[model samples]
Target: TKIKNEFPVFKNKVDGKKLIYFDNACTVLKPKSVIEAMNNYYQNLGVCSGDRSSHLLSWRVQELVEQAREKVREFINASSTKEIIWTKNTTEGINLIASSFPFKKPRDEVVLTLLEHHSNLLPFYEQGKRRGFKIRIIVPNKDGSLDLNLFKKIITDKTALVAVTHLSNVTGLIYPIKKIISLAHQKGAKVLVDDAQYIATHREDVQKNQMDFMVFSGHKIGGPTGIGVLYGRESLLNNLFSYNVGGGTVQSVKIHGNNIKVQYLPPPAGFEAGIQDYAGIIGLKAAVNFLEKQNQEEIADYIEKLSHYAFEQLKKIPEIKFLADYQNQIPATLISFYFSDKKVSLYDFNLFLNHELKDYFVAVRCGHHCAQPLHQFFNTSISMRASFFIYNSTKEIDILIQALKDFFNRKK
Candidate 1:
């Protein structure tokens, strides 16, 4: 496919074999367009922007940064560019909300799920401790699907914020975000969605979802690392305190007696402190443009088919057991499973697979996948994961199955 060729990483070799990367959940390979865009920015008009200077180069840089913000605002269907805050990644975006969102009472609550990545979990946990707020965690069903009934019972009037992942990175299970958002709103609670995994392949309409806030990493969507987006309701953002205070975030400063007065800029600028990642931001805009050309729904459907084929092939092996049932959960972009025999550790099996499939360049992820709570719920420490993306093919799944079969046969 032409899309596959767009990524120059495919041309590279690993250990004398073509590179086959299946770790889309962690990060995606950058397309040439994204790389060129970043390189072009660095090569030309690379200068500090925003209030720092009035030079022609500085103005060009400022224009590029603002243009990137508009692209991200349109990408997620946010109301205005003012609501778009530049963050280092999904983790920092969530941290910004956790630290800055107004929690009035001591008993105010923050709700989350067991399926969250550490990035989504840690910030809330740390902030809740300091702010004297209670955190309620909802456990998913045995099938790894969220229980809406339980979720409804947990979010009460006292719940100030509901932080949830739009999709489970480990299980590839999509959450009912629109319903969750509606329920949270009914209880007067704001919703913050961690869309790190979902935004890469799915079209997230923040206005349609009625989301108060959303976060996603650029690296996961064919963009450069060190660039991410945070979408917040403009009203909510304006009321909240800035997470970081420094240079460009402030409009003016005054000194009188022992106290100093500072005037801060509105929303986006207020939250983004110091010099931003100009090149990475530009590359993210390029990535968004590249992805918009391809229909997100079509890409999702294609990945789901690949997941279904992989699941069926893996199910043929009696020793294999899935973390969740894939039949009921259609359109999964990934699958997590482990050998039931328990003779081989997940790490050992991953090493074996990597060695055996070096020629075919089959690569997969094997670990707790940064969701320890979810693994604990299943009573499993770790498992193997094969994630599918737009560039992946059914032929790759076939090769993976054959490799697994060969490994099992050799073990016997």
Candidate 2:
């Protein structure tokens, strides 16, 4: 596809081999549109404090942030643009909710899953430590798939929130999110989906799924790093107090005695604490526009087909073992296998391969892909990962396979 050509990285050669980058799960390559959009922001209007200025250039930058919020609102089918809050990244978004949002003392349980990334897990841990709340964890199966039965048992009347990933980055397994949300709601617990790995890749419509909240990273969706989205239900957000307040986010500030009585602005504004990333926000909106034009479904399907083919081809290597044989289902890029035997670490063998197979590209990974808790359920040691995206094709996978087999033969 011309998509591969659009990325300059593919055209660049390494050791006489065209660079074969299969690490889409880590962070996707931004397209020309996202690049051009950010460049234009700097070239045309590189103004600081967009909201504070009355100049037209400053107003343009201000509109960019708002437009990005609106675009994300549309992306997730949020009820109102005001419900979409800008964050540094998904980790920050999760932290924002944990640190800022107020919860009743009696209803303080935070439910997370074994498949959660560290970004989604640690904030809850810290929050639990501070709030003196019990953090309940849902265990996944040996193959890294979640057990919804366990989830039903955990979320109770005392549960304040249920935060889970929409897809497993380790196993490429899609969770039963709609059912999870329904169960959480029945228990009067709010649901927050960490869509960092799935958002633009999975085509998630939060409103259609009746999702109460959602979060995702911009870098994963072909935008710049350091930008994220926090989508909250309009009603739910209005009731919750802002964790951070500054600049135009507050309507009026008043000092009464030693305490402060501030008339906080509504969400979107109220949630945007401190100075915003105007250029990054503009790039994020451009990224959304890029996804919209290509059609999210088309991009998803194309990437899925490539990932499925990679899975099939990679399974042919005798030395490799799969965590789960889920080529027919799952929407994630690709995740499977490690280089070591029972006695050895996958990191060691994969490192040898990466060094020895310098003549060709064999995209592989080791270590828990940040889902360390889930790793206990499936992998005894870290597994190798080679993920694909819309820009990837069969030719690239073929190169990776040959390089891998050659290294294995040399080692033996």
Per-model RMSD to reference: 1.3, 2.2
lDDT of 1 by residue, 1-412 (tens): 6878999988887777776778888898899999999999989878888558998889898899999999999999998999999999999999999999999874399999998999999999999899888899998877778889987899998999999999899888899999999999888999999999999888999999999999999999999999999999999999897788898889999999999999999988899899899999999999999888878889788888888898888889887888865545753788889989887666776776667665756678988999988888887888888888889988888877887887888778
Q: Per-residue CA lDDT of candidate 2, range 1-412, in tens?
A: 6776666566666666546677777888888888889899889888865667888888788888777778888888887887888889998889888876667877988999877889989998998788677788888766566777888899999999999988767787678899999999999999989887787677888888888878999988889999888888888888776677788688888888899888878887888877788878989998888888888888878877887787778778877777764534643577567654565456665665455555554456677788766666664546778777777778878877776676666656
Off by over 4 Å in 2: 325-331, 340-345, 348-363
Candidate lDDT (C-alpha), each: 0.88, 0.79
| Model 1 local distance difference test score | 0.88
Off by more than 4 A, model 1: none
User: How accurate locally is residue 257 in candidate 2, as Cα lDDT from 0 to 100?
Assistant: 86
Q: Candidate 1, TM-score vs. the true structure? A: 0.97
Compute the lDDT for candidate 2: 0.79
